[model samples]
Target: MSRRRVKPSLYISVDIEADGPIPGPYSMISLGAAVAGRQDAGGFTPADPEEHTFYRELRPISAEFDEQALAVSGLDRDRLCREGADPAAALSEFTAWVGEVSTGAQPVVCGYPVAFDWMFLYWYLIRFTGGSPFGHSGCMDMKTLYAAKAGLPLRAVAKGTMPRHLLSRRPHTHHALDDAVEQAELFANLMAWEGPGA
Candidate 1:
C-alpha cells in the first residue's frame, strides 16, 4: 500500500573560470552557482537566483597556466596564490551548499554550454571532494535545450540567434557569479518558453 516518491529536479546554474583547456594540467580558478529553479510533475518553478548562490575563487593546483586563458578571467593568479581558497575546502563547501539548497530535490546543474563547465566541475569535485552532488548524469545544457525547443540546429544556435525575449537582461560579465546568475534567468525563461510557432 506504499506509493513511490518522485524527487523534483533542482536546476542549478553553474559557471567556472579556469586557467587552461583541461582540468589536470589547469585548475579551476573560480566557481559560481545559483539555484535557477525546480521541476517536477507540476512543471518548473523558478527561483530568485540572487537569493541562493555560491562563489569561490580557488588557489591554483599547479604552477603551469596558459596566459591567454588566464587573461579572459582577469583574475590575478598572483593574488590568488596568496589568498584563494584551498581547492578541497572550497569544493567541500560547494558540495554542502548544493546539498542545502537541493534538500528534498535532485541537484541538476545547467550551463550555457554545459560540457565545458561540467568537465571542470566534475573533475574538481571528484579530485577535491571525492564526489559530486550531481552524481554522474545530473546535467543539462542550455544551448542544447534551446536548440531542441526552438527547433534549430545546435551548431547554429547561439545567444545571438535566440529571440530577445528569451535572453536575460543581465550582461555577460566574465565574472563567474555574474554569468551564473545571468544563465539562471535565461534557464527560467527557456523552461517557460513554448518555442517558436507554438
Candidate 2:
C-alpha cells in the first residue's frame, strides 16, 4: 500500500519598505525576499541567505505619504514614481519567482515582526496581481515565534532582550534587500535554535 506524501514548507524571508504605515492609501516602495529554509514533517534545514532571492522597487500608488516613514528608507518617491517598475509587473514577477523557487513545497512568508511587512506585501500582491504567493494565512512572524518558543511575554520581546546569539550579525538597515537578508539570517537562527539559554 502506498502512503500519502506531504509537501514541505518553503520559508521565504520577506521585507518591504513602504512610504507609509498602511497600504492602498500609501505604497510599498520596495520589496526583498530570500529563502530562509525548508522543513517537512520530519525535519528542517536552513538555506543560505544569498540563494533564491528576489528584490524590486515599485512606483508609488498614492501621492500621500508619511515623511518620517519615507525618510527612513531614503527612497525618493518622485524618482520611484518615474523609474520604478509598475506594481502589477513587479508583483507578478515576484509571485513567479516564488513559484519557481518553491517547487515541491508550500511557499510560506517569514519576516521579523511580520505584522508590518506582511501587511504591506499581502495587500500589494492581492491588489496588484489579484492573488498572493502567500495565501491570506501563509505567514510566520519571527518575533512571535521567538517569544513563544522562549516562554516570554510578547511585550518583553525585543532584539535587545533576546540573546545575542539569536540575532543576525547583519545590521537592520531600512533598505528592503538588506533587511530581507538580515531577516533571513535571523529566521534561520531561530529555526535551528532550541530556545533561550540553549
Candidate 3:
C-alpha cells in the first residue's frame, strides 16, 4: 500500500483590532486568523477554523483605549483584563500555533488593509520574540490587490463594495477575528473569480 503525501499550499489570513492606529502607542485588543489550504484532491477550506485555531484577546498595554475603536469592537477593558492573555504569552502561543498549522510552509499572512494589522503584529512579534517567523516583508493586502486588479480607486473599495456575506451581519464591528474572516472570504472570492492568474 502506498502512503498518500499531503501537498500543502497553506496561507494564514490575520486581523488585529487595536485601540488605535499607531502600533506601540496604541494597544491591540484582539487577534484572529483563518488558515486555509487544499486537502487531498477536493475538500472545502473553511474561513472559520473548525476547532477555533487562532483567536485571542490581549490585555491592553497602554493606559488609554480609543473610544471609537472600543465602540466598534465592543471589547470592554474590564472584560479584556478578565479574559485576555498577557501580550508576550499570547504572541508566543500564536506564533507556535502558526508553526503547527503551516507545518514548515511559510504561509502568507493576509489582511483587508494589511498595512494596519501587519504593522501592529509585526511590532508585537518582534518585541516579544526578537523576530517573526513570517518575514519582515511580503504581506498580501486584499484592498491593494483589489484596487489594482479591478481598476478601482482605493476609496471605492470600502466596506460597502466588499461582499456582504463575508462581513458580520451586524454593523461595523472591529473585532479582529470577525474582520479577519471577512477579509479571507473576500480574498477567496476574488481568487475564484480571477483564477489566481489575475
Specify the highest-lDDT model's number.
Answer: 1
* Model 1 CA lDDT for position 123: 97
TM-score of each: 0.97, 0.96, 0.79
lDDT value for model 1: 0.97
Off by over 4 Å in 1: 1-4
What candidate 2 gets wrong by more than 4 Å, as runs, is: 1-4
On TM-score, the candidate that comes out on top is 1
As for model 1, its CA RMSD to the true structure in angstroms is 1.3
Off by over 4 Å in 3: 1-9, 38-52, 162-172, 195-198
Q: Report RMSD (Å) for each prediction in the order shown.
A: 1.3, 1.5, 5.2
Task: Tell me the TM-score of model 1.
Answer: 0.97
Residues 1-198 of candidate 1 have per-residue lDDT tens digits of 997989999999999999999999999999999999999999999999999999999999999999999998999999999999999999999999999999999999999999989999999999998899999889999999999998989999999999999999999988999999999999999999999987
Is 1 or 3 the stronger prediction by lDDT?
1
What lDDT tens digits, residue by residue, belong to model 2 across residues 16-88? 9998989999999999999999999978889998878899999999899999999999999999999999999
Q: What lDDT does each candidate get?
A: 0.97, 0.92, 0.72
TM-score winner between 1 and 2, please give it: 1
